[model samples]
Target: MDNQVEKKKKTNPFLTYFKDLGTAIAKGDVSVKLSMLFMGAGYTFHKQVIKGILVTLIEIAFIIMCIFYAAPNLAKFGTLGTVQFEQVLDPLTLQTTVNDYDNSFTILLNSIIALFLIVCFILFWISNMKSVYRLQVLDNEPESLTKKHINTFREDVRSLFSEKFHLTLLSLPALGVILMNIIPIFVLIAIAFTNYDQAHMPPNALFTWVGVSNFKSLFANSLTVTFGYAFRKILGWTLLWAVLATLTTFIFGILLAMLINSKTTKLPKMWRTLFIVAIAVPQFVTLLLVRYFFGDTGIVNSICSNIGVTEFLKSVGLVSQHLNYIPFLSSEHWAKFMIVMINIWVGVPYQMLIATGVLMNIPSDQIESAKIDGATNFQAFIHITMPYILFIQGPSLITDFVKNINNFNVIYLLTNNAFITPDQKLANSNAKEVDLLVTWLFRLTNDYYNYKMASVIGIIVFVICAVFTILSFTRMISGDREGDYQ
Candidate 1:
């Protein structure tokens, strides 16, 4: 028996759980088998009348829900609807009447809701099965033990406040997350598989499930060739912007923090305060102010024009003399460049503060050792400070990269009025030269009323962010080089 126990300990945990489950199933009597077909049979056999009735009520409710909501919608989920609204003449009254139209939006919304309900029902059914199996196993125990251990509804309620208090605390938050985040994500993903665009607007025209047709439109179709081109351009720019914004801010922020922390620097607090003021202002306000200042007729350009700076640039063959304005936001290359530069300004102060705190924690011994070895300041920084900061901030850098990919405000606000010129517009799409996938999605939904395309772009953006995040973390974990510093 001791040898068997020791051998069992060496077996896989999942294998053990299945083995125990199989044993319980084999030991189940007719009541347990009946419960599989009739949800509450085992509980009724165990004389838990209220529990049995409650379980049976849930099954009944699920049946009614399926019949009323889920079945009808699921049937139409394959083809959203076929009917379109049309005006018909009422012969007797000699008046025009609107015929009943199938609403595609209602169908899509209800189908998503029904799918959610079905999933919930399936989960509940699994729980019901598990409960029956658990009760059956308890019944097979010794009678005295079963009598002492068996829980009534009242006892279960008492256990929630006592032994299961953690579950009680977590339940509301878990439910909130499922309803708010998970359900919405599922709906977004489902929308991508349909044709719910402007042309298929509800109550006038019907939209249907098109499987991978939206994805195909994005990648292969000649009619949407411009969208493919726009996607490639935006994706490339998004990645480049994220990388540049993350690295440039990190490097410059660390340098600024180091400068302020140096003993020779006087009035460090004053210098830090000056930088903190930039961060203290709301980001939107700053971006808006910056945008205005850089506008053609705004203060910066006004001052430059007054000072003949624009004329000097034209004289030096930098810009055409025919143009009076610098075209900061109007020119695509200039706009992209200025967006990065402005992002650095807005982002650096926060990074500096973070770097300052991290820099303070670095052990003095390592720097002192490097100094004693006659290493130059640059060498010491490269070998010790860089590694230490990178090790500590690696995960944060990944998050920053992801954040920059979706940094809609910086790109959107700065060039909102200027970037979209007639020449830059995609042939059949809402995308422009300066638009990231995130901003493009916004334009598609809000400007073009192309929800299907927006949802597809949203899914693609999520995939890009998720893939990059996962790959970065995987590389960081697999390398495991952070331990070298320790």
Candidate 2:
């Protein structure tokens, strides 16, 4: 058993796949060999006429697409098009006629898409060869050679609806994933390696691959663009925000649920319903309304000003004495505080419902025993309630942390026109002090048209989230928690 385990661990599955490929090519019959050069040729040899026709049509369509759609872009992909955009005068009309220009972005995009399609085509061709080889082998068998035993196109269609139904169901979803998710992700990564900034705006200007220059710039400081400094600050704040946001919501939600559910509490149903009302309203509307409430000259400021609260704050040096209104969403510390507080307001109710459901399902005996042992309510809640909630919602907590890391709406909407970065380094880097990685990426792409740096930040965000999730989940499942829980 030990030897077998060692052998299994030593084996590389990818190498095994190539070994199988070699066997299929060398040992396959004549029809299979034909399939290497011509798709569906083996199907035709096996007399599957309808299937062969369909497969052949697919191959022909791909050939046409390569010629018309992929080739022109791919030809110029290396230099991302050399033709400069120009305008000319028509002597007769005396109108400026624009010359045909090669768009750099278009060339890069089309080339990546073409390469992806070629890879998919290669995989499909390999599968076709393997399939045809099996059919050719069956042809020599005494039973398989019989007409009654031979597989028909109609039978294959029937099988797709029966034993192979999953394939039919998954086909469209797989295509959608490739088009929407896979292709765009490839483009994003590819853009990280190039200089696709505002200066290289397509049609008028050209951007070329700068190799790892973007990545290097991201980690190193510059006088004009202090990206390394901005990244370190934004990354630190992003992580801190995610941790605080997730835990605050989760912990407060649990406490809220406990408070409402407690026998000492009055009108629990009314309280729960009130909390649900927050959930009923659209989040963006609520966020926008709150943005106004906390604005420089908004109602909150007016109330504070009227009550001498603004003066009190000014005396304490919390608000600037030079300014009349307190900078709730404008100042860095103040904005970060308000964002999290408002998020707790917006986010806690949903979590409360989740925590409420989980708390009810906790083993009653554990809580009863803790009480019997003279543990106070708070102690029992901490030792029993907290651990149980953490165990049940471990995956959810991880998801919440990741979600908060990329929570763009709250950060963007709250600070849209209100918040301005006071720090010169952050402002120069196209970042705000309170900006999360996701919001910074959005600002770089949407506001500044700095796609190169945005893509690099995007990749960083992906890596950070991916690494945390993998490590957290690995630790969660590797524990002997069933013993304790049961």
Candidate 3:
């Protein structure tokens, strides 16, 4: 009975089909059996060609819909949102405004495209069904998978590899990367071409493709504000911040870590734990608390008043008479400075922890040998310790630099709405003083609802991060060729 059961299992065409599927996937090609089946049927080939034509037609139609119908309608929506209803004198003019019903051609084109996609998708579905049906027919035929001849083949494959566990483990992380990260990024990248501005907020109002106009306006010519000022200023500051923040944090973090690990210092664990406490707390909570302390009526100002720095500033007339309380978090330049300093406070602890771990891995013998040669502490650090730590931890340091560039919560929470200026002349509509590109992008989408620009900014951020990551990887593998570290 057992031998007969093994023979029946060996002849299972379901199992054979799976084995073939594995081989096809490994070779990065569709199953030859399925391809042959499609090609074998003249009707199937005709339908596939038709499906391709329909897909191309639908894409062209989608683009045309956006340019002719949706763009004009959306412009009307923007104009209406900007103007008061009572301001327009001509009833006919007002009727043609965004407040009027959506353009019928836009609706018709969209509906047609939607229906076209649905039909083509159904055709693909039908193709899959037909293939499955054919496979099942093959499975049932005695000549295809005979009941008594295939036991040895199954046993031979089982001895090779545990294919089930191998595939399951390999696919889990890849599936997560595709679904969670890659898909959202692709969708956001696509959104950049659309007219998803404040006026045409999605679900309530539809947005359409606007070509490269968003990038053009953002980079060079903008009707809303002077073209290059906002972009250049924000970009310059972002670059400056990335450099200063990383350098300041790295220099200080490494210095602190070295100091704590110094032979002269006592209670290393206690000092390390103290710094750890800063990083141990949620950063948002720490940032919010710091923001409040620096607010108009906050303790920092009250303490400054007691210390007579406020009186000194008042006497010097640095602060205007109208301004009674110091606006640490309010003034743009001051806010930028304060955010950087607060970043140092929040940032250094983690670097210190990382440096400490990396420092421990540095050979004690290297330092001992340097000290025996009558080298001072600083000389020993420079000649013996620093290079080893930097080599191992260079990647992390670059990552920290990238992290600080997009460090939203620290900048956003600390500065709050203070960076926002109501004057249209100030920025790319609704920008704040201390807003990083990420925070600015978030404000565009979340507050102002200018999703097209938000998407544009998102692409810019991606490019910046991608560039930095590539550079970091290059540096990590190649080392600092300048010979400064060595």
lDDT of 3 by residue, 1-486 (tens): 999988977889687556555543343223323443343232223233443344345446655766775555455543223322222346765543234444322443344344444465545444543443443344345774354332233443463456555765667797787568865676677568767676775334556566798888777745665434566666777778888888778878988998998888899999999898988899889888998888888999999988988878877876556776777888776777887888889878877888888888888998888899899988888877788877787787778778877988887888765545544644655666566788878877788878777888889888999988988888776765677767
What is the lDDT, from 0 to 100, of the residue 146 in candidate 1?
35
Tens-digit lDDT track for model 1 on 272-340? 999999889988999989999888777888888899999998799766678897777777777888888
1-486, model 2: which lDDT tens digit per residue? 999977875787776666666777898877778778777788898888788888888899999989998998899999998888998989999999887899999999999999988888988887777778777777767664353555799999999999999999999999999899988889999999999999999989989999999999998997986999999999999999999999999989998999898989899889999999997998889889999999999999999999999999999999877989889998998899999999899889989899889988999899999899999999998899889988889887898899999999899999988999889988999899889999999989999999999999999898988987886778677874788857
Cα lDDT over the full model 3: 0.67
What stretches of model 2 exceed 4 Å from their correct place? Answer: 1-12, 144-148, 472-486
Rank list by TM-score: 2, 1, 3
Best by lDDT: 2
Weakest 10 consecutive residues of candidate 1 by summed lDDT: 419-428
TM-score of 1: 0.88
Candidate 3 Cα deviation (angstroms), residue 216: 0.4
Question: Which clashing pairs does model 2 show?
Answer: none
TM-score for each model: 0.88, 0.93, 0.67
